[model samples]
Target: MGNSSSIQAADASGFTQSRSLSRSFFGAAALALVIILPGCATYSSGFAKVEQAAAVRDLDGAVKTLDELKLTGADEALHHLNKGTLLRLQGNYAESNKHFDIAKELADKLNAISVSEQLASVSVNDTMKAYEGLPSEQLMLYSFKALNYLQMSDVDAAAVEARQFDIKQSQIAKQNADAKYLSGAFVRYLNAMVYEAAGERDSARIELQKALDGYKKQNSGFPVPASLTADLARIKAGKPAPSEVVFILQNGLGPSLHEATVRIANPNPQNGSSLLSLAVPKLAKRSVPVARIELSAGSAVASAEVVEDVNDIAEKSLNDRLPGITARAVARMVVKNAAVGETKKRSNELGAFGLLANIAMDVGSAVSERADTRTWSLLPGVINMARLPLPAGKHDITATYYSESGAVLATRVFKDIEIKPGRKAFVSDYYLNPPAQAKAPQ
Candidate 1:
């Protein structure tokens, strides 16, 4: 393609020589879209600075960077999701939940009908529409909310969030009856734990059974922890623990996204829309640095078992929705072709400007054919848990993160971790194998 400014100058000189005002206006507008729109960045690309800050475990810096991106209305949902995560990591549960609540509300609003965004999605690109997080992501959002509430020492709010997670997961499961599910065993287990902590044995028993069933049903490339079965039995037989410490380990960064483009002939030639390419989002799975986290307190030691594989769930969720995503992308290509053809027919009235319009539309379409790669990128790749029964007392807590090889990766020490009688102490941590490379751009 020739330089846009040079071509525009040449076109303008011709228009001025002919003294055609109408042609000049149309040429200016069409060429502007072609030149300016093509330089527009994808949603994922805007996160470079945010990812860099987050990689260094600078939660505040990451949030600031994300806020500085100055995203559009379409990016509001993702902005809140990212900020919520950053705040959540900062241990500011209140602030995190505030952003998360706003995010959830935005997602709900986005789900409602919006003809302009919908049309734009089909004609320009998927990112034209407001971001609606995947089902698994919504679940994760709820899980995070529940965890935030738990961390705030509000068992009631946590239970409510947990129940909401279950309800939403069940609805999604019913809708995708044929497909494998995330099963949401972790949330159910968390609900049970919350109940147990609140001394609600019956409710705990019910959620525990569901959790046990969920783990058995889910194949997240991890074995169902033996503790779940034992917990079920103990709960059923009314064996209440004296005290416990539940470790919730978020392992590695969640899979981010990248675009995959392919040029192919229009599938439906009869539609009067000729197109050559499609761009769709694909999962960019990150490497897991730590296989599991081991927690040791005095003489008692337990390894947190993987319960949810965020990578696997994200892959499955995208696969479940790929056909629709690709269909929209194909439709976008067709619309672009149609637009280019229409531009050629209308702009021809301007003589030389017709070719300019054609070039602008063609190049603009090619450049704008990016996939909607927005996602909750800061989520954990895998979730692991360990319920260790300990006597009520202060003890030095040591957490060791290990690699798949038996090599130690990192360790954390929490001095004077207190376990109260008949109460559950919660410990949560996030681990990224190599923090700096967590969200390396593709």
Candidate 2:
């Protein structure tokens, strides 16, 4: 919370309630702050109309709604990220990349802030600051940008993104040695394929190994794709293998943050049933539609398994930062309590004006206690991948995504996929669960 001192605890004891001013005038300023600003707003409520459109696969409508909202300030980065993903899903790769570029620049600028700089903004709340994005969101920004390039058949640009992501994650890993989200194994797996497509076998092999090491090192709760092992072994033999079809699937929606308020016990029981309520952000997991993706390229088949669980990474990422968030909240509440207590003290002496002042102070304290819930809400919860090595020729590929309960949720088919010798072709998709079917009575 920044600039919280703007609310002074001092009383205007001499201000007359009768002929000097209308009774309503006394509370106007305080009421304005509470009424005019979205101090207690959450992401879900703000994005409700747009999300409703997206829930039904009306992506164009969703994009249009977002455009109409014209969100600004700290959340502009997330707005761009949402638009970019929606556009990508619509197969608008160029436009998607343009928006992603804007988001990347904004995030990079915010990331330049030092710890001291952040501490200086202690009085400024999260809603007022530029969003730098969480580690998982930042990582996916690179991944989606690369995927957009790949969709446009721009292997070189994709490779460039791969390298940049590698450098970025390396720096992140060094700074946060114990952060499991630093693994970047999903992105590494993707980069390996990008290198392979670029005819950089040595770089491809190296990245594949790095991906293996990252998966093991991070222990991110996702089992390494068994296909990765087969990939490394085959590449190690240095044989000129036929080109392959790599099916990349982004599965289910990612988790979102919601406010969770906890009431702390009173240090002195005489004070009442509660001391203060601490508001914090908590991850709300999204639906899990695609548990496994079964892919078949003619006779050759491979099952795409989880390379990354974004929900888990996002949860762990937020958990790592909660201590600092909690501490700031505690400090902010202390400031609010002092202001409220001051108003309460002068309420009797100041008469009607003081009572109104007390009411405003109480409202301000509750409104200011809201938790920040912004996030890259459009991202998928899981990244699933499968590889099929076919002889250099045209082949038919079928991909079917399943739920954990083994129900078929979706199926995608790519016809006449051509694979060249010593190269890789990719077929990628994003999936959401079909409308939940009505169940029969038992």
Candidate 3:
């Protein structure tokens, strides 16, 4: 699976609520002075710096400087919108959504009643016209809305919104290559997602390729949100459809060392069942299987074997000459000739999956006072066993590092609070401690 960082929050309301009026007054006085004084290039210079920071992924710097701009009350909506964009880059979706909502509200208030009515009609022409008057801040808001729609599996609506943005730019004779690329690429991406969901493997692969090409041409590289890349790869490979499987790898999280590993096998060897595997190293002592689905048609039947601990096999020496592990011993399946479809009915069963382990190193011959040991899992998208079904409320998730034999070395806990969904409001801080070192008995 492709690994990448999460999208940052792009909400701008926090900046607007705190620094609107005073900046407006100061900006007017500065404008008058600019006419009298000749050396005032601060505004242009500052905005340029912010843009540069954003391009390079320095989101914090971009947000800090953008917040300092002193736009008039008329431009307040746009300012908040820009802030939202910065937050989105930082992967704060909830806050980014808040800014988008606020921007929409402000835009509604400023527009003529008739203009609002026309926009509400959802006509492309009318929406294009309405978008033109919007400040730069809201451009990203439209982009984010389109992205959200895609996430919700509403491809048609996303395509419509993207088209509106494209048409509006053409009508105004304003060319934003980045915006154009994003609109085109996103629509294609959504189309691919729809095709994948419908089990049209070839069609999905073609569309995803188009989307990837468009994004690369526009931004000169793959999109920053790495999740899309993994999805694209899965589609191209014709593995468990994107809708049927989820990849949990993200950027900034350290290497997945002990997470589970999953593998899928085909029951009928001739038709070549799709084989998919992922290694999740951050969740548990060994990786857990996220999915091990079986697919078949008519007389052709295929099964997937998901193994959690492949490390055991890796640990054994080939010289040992032992049957390390077998596929049937570790996986679940569905047979087309089952008397009563028992396999199909119990497809969700995970208890049957087993690990193929090998004894890598013998601790019996160790001479040191402390022994260090490491284990690995072979599946991807497995959630941390300790952090599953987090209760609704705010929580701080932490990861602790350990030295092979299980000696705690360091711990890291994220400060950002995540709101869970529940009335009782469960709030707790999680810890990731390093493994401890084992002491040999004297």
Candidate 4:
């Protein structure tokens, strides 16, 4: 975007700003380096334990492990997101919303940090800073929070989240309208359902249309649910549709993050060409088959189909970020290499003390080279949904989880679920096959 000299000048400015933030720069930097380098991988092992607990359907064990996480600095956002989702799956709606609310606030604060933080990251590593969260994760905060409100029968609160989701979508559009969806079709669909629950059919119809239009734009190869179309038709004709039992399914585990290396050619060819590389973390998709669920009430049965594959959403969201990540990594590498060159030049001029300084800088560089691999890892691979109309009364419903090849894996039965006339009943479940190896971020 500018000449090489100007870019280097900007880097120097960044360094100056970072230094101005502290009185004891060297001491603070050293302590930060020590704390961050070792603490970066702290959550991985603990989250693995949480994953193990979740695998066996031990909700209490999962919560216990989650509560034990050493959440500080960049770990805070990820910790809240994971803890919140886990609690939601565990049927702790109010508690889950509390965590999610904290996550949203932290994410907003992180996203609004000073430019000096960006510059500091060049030398200290991104993980040494706060986690700003992925776009998908940010949108998901509202989605889940809205669902939590719905579960509590607080339709007004859920509508607030729906409005917030729209605001985020508008901001994303302003930034880059041509980019893929900021929020997914499923979120919009949920918004419509929420509006409908609040006796706002006109608003619901509008949201339903947006949902249909957004899904078409997503082009994710998933067809619009037949039942959704029927609902839209009924809403358009002003005919009241039956109150239904809705299942929001989180199936399998989401992708995991790992590190990879990228090499950049020397920017200044006259200084003798060299290859510079940085280890960058990226999301690696774990293969999990698309999931389906069958809901049965006595002899009548209905199938739950995949409406939103969150794994696909995460993949696309990460993919959209690849260009920005590469650019930032390249810029950071350039700044760090320049710092090394400056230090080496001073070392040659000042003898022993400068030599020690240069050595210390080298050690810091090596230790701080890791990629930022933090995420809300416990998210489901896919989100399947189904709506079944039931007469206003208490009824027993059975939900069967199935694998990709139509093999039944597990079944859960809920007895005496009460459905009120002209009102929606909500139900949800999580199911996955056990992982072959331990994974973190749940």
User: After TM-score superposition, what is the CA distance of residue 401 in candidate 1 from its true location, in Å?
Assistant: 1.1
Which RMSD values do the candidates have, in order? 6.3, 7.8, 32.2, 10.0
> How far in Å is the alpha carbon of 135 misplaced in model 4?
1.9
| Per-residue alpha-carbon lDDT of candidate 2 for residues 202-226, written as tens digits (9 for 90 to 100) | 9989999999998897687878789
- Best-to-worst order by lDDT is 1, 4, 2, 3
For model 1, residues 346-396, the per-residue Cα lDDT tens digits are 665665665565556556666778888889878888888877788898877
TM-score of 3: 0.29
What are the runs in model 3 whose C-alpha is more than 4 Å off?
Answer: 1-34, 37-68, 73-78, 89-95, 101-143, 148-183, 194-240, 243-442
Judged by lDDT against the true structure, how good is candidate 2? 0.74
- Please, what are the lDDT tens digits per residue for candidate 4 over residues 167-258? 88767667666656554578888888899888889989988898888777877777887767777898999988586788787877888777
Deviation of model 1 at 63, angstroms: 2.0
Over 4 Å off in model 4, which ranges? Answer: 1-46, 263-275, 348-360, 436-442
**Worst lDDT 10-window in candidate 4:** 268-277
TM-score of each: 0.88, 0.85, 0.29, 0.84
Per-model CA lDDT versus the true structure: 0.77, 0.74, 0.36, 0.74
- CA displacement after TM-score superposition, residue 231 of candidate 2 (Å): 2.1
- lDDT accuracy of residue 331 in candidate 3: 20
Better of 3 and 4 by lDDT: 4
